[model samples]
Target: MSVVVSFKVRREVKELMDKYRDRVNWAEELRRFVEEKIRQLRAEENLAEILEELRKAGWSVPKGFSVKSVREDRDSR
Candidate 1:
């Protein structure tokens, strides 16, 4: 069946979430974003070797760049 997980959050954050909750399904949106980021990080083309290889075949990663960001929860206004 289903289980419920409860926690607490800041007042301002809670109000912000309540405002946008109707327009977005938070669970589904969060799941999709995380899955895509993981896939990109673990791809086979990520093995950087030669100059042309790094440019055309493999992933070109920099010192610091990531799609993921900090997350917070909100309950009510």
Candidate 2:
């Protein structure tokens, strides 16, 4: 279940890519790059949604909370 995707590149860019045609699988390279970009974008979108929900609920930490918590955990260990 796959479809063809195509785009045009500058003439110089195409020439450079053609030079390495035997050493590279351009289709696979483009596919992996696109897949990785989509994953990164989705993760960012999810993070933004979570932050918005926290903001709406007025969620926040008091000043020095991180330092105090870290020191307490270190002392216990």
Candidate 3:
């Protein structure tokens, strides 16, 4: 399912776009840009939620915990 989406650009911008109309797929380009932007925003929102959950749980790691864990894994390999 698809719907019509429209927006106004500056006259200069519209003129520039028109100039390259033959070389560019403007609708696809705008759709991809909007899709990417939505993905980026969703990722940020998900991260914020995860961080809030972590904060509520008061989770913390000891200093050097990551380094020590990595060293142990390498030694076992």
Query: TM-score: which candidate is best?
Result: 2
TM per candidate comes to 0.41, 0.79, 0.78
For all candidates in order, the CA lDDT equals: 0.66, 0.98, 0.98
* Worst-scoring 10-residue span by lDDT in model 3: 54-63
Clashing pairs in 1: none
* Candidate 3 total steric clashes: 0
Q: Worst ten-residue run, lDDT, model 2?
A: 20-29
**Regions of model 2 farther than 4 Å from truth:** 66-77
Task: Residues 22-45, candidate 1: write the lDDT tens digits.
Answer: 998876776788789888876644
Ranking by TM-score: 2, 3, 1
Evaluate candidate 1 by giving its C-alpha RMSD to the native, one decimal: 17.8
In terms of TM-score, how similar is model 1 to the real structure? 0.41
Cα distance off (Å), candidate 3, residue 41: 0.2
For model 3, how does the per-residue alpha-carbon lDDT over 1-77 read when each residue is reduced to its tens digit? Answer: 99999999999999999999999999999999999999999999999999999989999888999999999999999
- Per-model root-mean-square deviation over C-alphas: 17.8, 2.5, 3.1
List, residue by residue over 23-67, the lDDT tens digit for candidate 2: 999999999999999999999999999999999999999999999
Candidate 1: list runs displaced more than 4 Å. Answer: 1-11, 44-77
Q: What ranking emerges by lDDT with the best candidate at the front?
A: 2, 3, 1
> Candidate 2, overall lDDT?
0.98
